[model samples]
Target: MARPTMEDVAARAGVSRALVSLVMRGSPKVSAARRAAVLTAAAELGYSPHAMARSLASRTSHVLGVMVSDLHNPFWAEVVDGLDGHARAAGFELVINTGGRSPARERRALRSLTSFRPAGIALLGPVVPSPAITAAADIPLVLISRSSRLSTVDTVNDDGRAGSALAVDHLVALGHRHIVHIDGGTGSQAAPRRTGYRLAMARYGLAPRVVHGEYTEAAGAAAIRALRRPFTAVIAANDLNAVGVLSALAEAGLRVPADVSVVGYDNTWLAALRHIGLTTIDQPRAEMGRLAASALISRVRGERTKPVRHLLRPTLVTRATTGPPPAPDPMP
Candidate 1:
């Protein structure tokens, strides 16, 4: 069957193609009754607008493009929900792509989004270089869960340093001293959190042990297994990684809190799951997303040329995973 077009919708509604175009563009000039009739006709014929082609012809776009670093992480998914809601409410649509945490792939994804000439673009935890991001400033750009020194682009991020400190403080309050951190090397927001963990440990007069790892479940499990000495607690890179740590601990016959307490960053849906119930730091994912969208839209509308940097504070949520340190002697 041939695909339906604007002509088909206009014919079905007994209107001109120009009237159908006006209704599709959401122009206020169209009468309410005619708009309803045209929409009903389009729906009945399954005729939807081609956003990219429309953008090219009109030199105006109602679409926003989004690029995510990793699709497997649930945190990004939740953030996207908030972004999509706000975008739709503002009479815009969204299309998404992921780079799977690869810098080269992320660069390519950025190019692909810009090719559409969207009203704006949002990058979530991108691993690409600053220059690549700066170049994309030809259109409005906003970053979530990442930072940039560029004045043209905006950024929305949780204070990773403070978030890490909260985790350390909570663990110390629970009587843990010998704690190890699973570091996310080169991942977005990794350096600050690593530095924060080190500083907090020194402030508490304890040695900080950092195991290099990536932002993935497998890396977390591998890093935990590589630890030679018995540590009182493990602070993971994120909730997904913490879940992996739990699996590795279970396999090693070490009971959580009784043997070692675990703390995770990014209080995502997985962290709140009844089965997982992980203790983690909350980054206000939804609000961050909304801020990113609003900032990008503001830039698109020429409301502001100066960058908007939105730094949010993170809070700690204590759950079943973290508790007091185990006694010196192992129970038989």
Candidate 2:
């Protein structure tokens, strides 16, 4: 049998469908006795109102669609926690899907979310192009950890340039001169971070060396293996990539912080693990999620037409993986 609807509940309770609608919408105009009767009948008959149908009738929806770039990334998981919490408290339901970091897949995911005509849509670390973001102009949309120049989309991001600079400065303060950066090539947050690293190198009178790579552990290991120069320090694009760097160095018998130091961005939970203890730049990911949800909801409620760009500050967290350069050999 098909799922029971409000009409079924109304018939079972000897009430009109309009009364059932009022009760379902939590209208104060309904009396307590009648409301209780409708609710009891609904529960008895297993009648559940159709959320989309109700939204169509009222011209509003409490649904918020969320698209996550990479489901495997722990950073995105933490961000979703904040988004879920804030959206729930405000009476919004979330539906989630992943793009696996591919532009083509992300475009499909965007379409899938928009099909529901949710009150708002949040894209987490999206890799889709700018034009694709612009095409979704009819809905209230927000981008988290991605950027858009379009007025239709709001954005939330930590200052990646500042984060990169903090990593370079930390290594330099520890007597590192031959420092190298493994970049997140083609990733959403890569360009600003790469530019920041280059700027910091110029400011400190040192040559900037960037190895082209993606934001992954495999990329980290491959970038390290491809390096011909012997550097005292390395900055990985993100924590996952940094872990790969450590693995590659270990395979080469290079002791961490004894022969070389390493720094990572996006201080993920993996970075804080006792065995890892990686030094990294901390982006307030949860806070960014909260802000993204808020921005999208404000647009959904017709509170603002202008875009909101939230660029948060990042901090450096020192750990065992970073230390001063190794002592030079004595004169033979």
Candidate 3:
């Protein structure tokens, strides 16, 4: 069957082509009853306006492009949910894609999003190079869980350093002197968290042992298996990594909180499970998402020129994971 067009919609709604066009463009000039008639007719015919063509005609778009670092991580999903809610409320829709945590793939994803000529773009925990990000300055850009020095870009990030310090402080308060931090290798915002951990350890006058790892369960498990020093507690890069540490410790016949306490960042739903209760830092994922969308929309509307950096505070959610260090054996 031939695809329906504005002419067909106009004929079905008993209105002129111009009226149908106005309704499709969301012009307020059209009467409420007439707009309803045209929309109903279009829906009946399963016809919708081509977004790109409409954008080209008006030089504006109702779409906002979003690039996420990893789809497998649930942390991004909460952020996207917040973004989608705010964007939809502002008469905008989101086009989301992921890079799977690969820089090359992220570059390709960025290019694909830019091809749509969206009104604005939001990058969530992106690992793409700074130059690649700067190249997209032609469009309004907001970043979540990433930082930028360019005045054209706006950033929304939780205080990773403060979050890490909170974790270290919690462990220290529980009498854990020997602590290990499994760092997120090359991950966005990793450096701040690592620095926070080191600084906190120094403040406590305790030696900090950092194990290089990626933001993954596999990396967490590997780091634990390769440990050469003794420690009473482990701080994972994120919730996923913390779960991996749990698994590795279980496999090695070590009980949590009894043998070695564990701490994690990013209080995702996975960390709240009854069976796998995890102590972690809360990043306000959804709030960050809303802020990112709001920032991008503000720029798209030409409401602001100065760049904004929103660094939200993080809090600790103590669950069943952390406890005081185990008592030493008294041998004869």
Candidate 4:
């Protein structure tokens, strides 16, 4: 069967082609009753407007292109929810794609979003190179859960330093001096978190041992296995990594919060599960998304040219995974 078009919709609604076009463009000139008729007819015929054609005709678009870093992480989902809600409320729609955390794929994804000539773009936890991101400067851009020194870019990030510090403080308070930090290697915003951990350890007059790892469960597990000596507590780069450490510890016959304690960053739902009970840092994922959307939309509307950087504070969520360090050895 031939695809439905504006002409078909107009014919079905008994309205002129001009009226159908007006309705499709969402022109306020059309009466509610006539708009309803056209919409109903279009729906019945499964007619859909050609977004590209419409955008070209108007020289603008109501679409916001989004590039996500990792599709597997649940934290990004919460962020996307906030972004979607705010975008829709402001008469915009989202077009989403992902890079799966690869720089090459992210560059391609950025080009793809730019090709649509979207009103703006939002990058979620992107690991793409700075030059690649700067190349897409034709439209407004927002970086979510990432940081950039470029004045042209806007960013929304949780205070990674504070988050790491919180974990260290909690562990130290529980008499854990032999704590280890598994760092997110080459990951966005990893430096601040690593710095925070080091500073906190120094403040407590304790030696800090950092394991080089990526932001992944496998990395966390591997880092643990590579450790030379047993530590009383472990601070994972993120919740996903933390879970992996938990698994490794269990396999090693070490019980959490008894034989050892583990803390993670990002209070994702996985960290809150009753069985897992992971202590973590809350980063307000949804709020970060909302802010990113707001910043991008503002620039798209030509409301501001100045850069806006949102650095939100992080708080600790104490759970069963953290407790006093294991008892020392009995008399030799």
Listed in order, each prediction's TM-score against the native is: 0.95, 0.94, 0.96, 0.96
Clashes of each: 0, 0, 0, 0
* Ten contiguous residues with the weakest lDDT in model 4: 51-60
Q: Local error of candidate 3 at 92, Å? A: 0.4
Per-residue lDDT of model 3, residues 128-227, tens digit only: 9999999999889999989999999999999999999999999999999999999999999999999999999999999989999988999899999988
Return the top candidate by lDDT. 3
Q: Which stretches of candidate 4 lie over 4 Å from their true place?
A: 1-3, 31-33
| lDDT tens digits, residue span 1-332, model 1 | 99898999999999999999889887999999999999999999999988887788679998999999999999999899889988888888898999889989999999998888899999999999888998888888899988887888899999999999999999999999899999888899999999989999999999999999988999999998988876989999999889889999999999997899999999998999988889999989889889988998888888888899999999999899989998787768
lDDT of 4 by residue, 258-295 (tens): 98899998899999999999999999988988998999
After superposition, which runs of candidate 1 have C-alpha atoms over 4 Å from their true positions? 31-37, 330-332
Off by over 4 Å in 2: 1-4, 43-50
**Global lDDT of each model?**
0.91, 0.92, 0.93, 0.91
Q: Rank the candidates by lDDT, best first.
A: 3, 2, 1, 4
Superposition-based RMSD of candidate 1 using all C-alpha atoms, in angstroms: 1.9
Q: What TM-score does model 1 achieve against the real structure?
A: 0.95
Poorest 10 consecutive residues of model 3 by lDDT? 50-59
The true-versus-predicted C-alpha distance at residue 315 of model 2, in Å, is 0.6
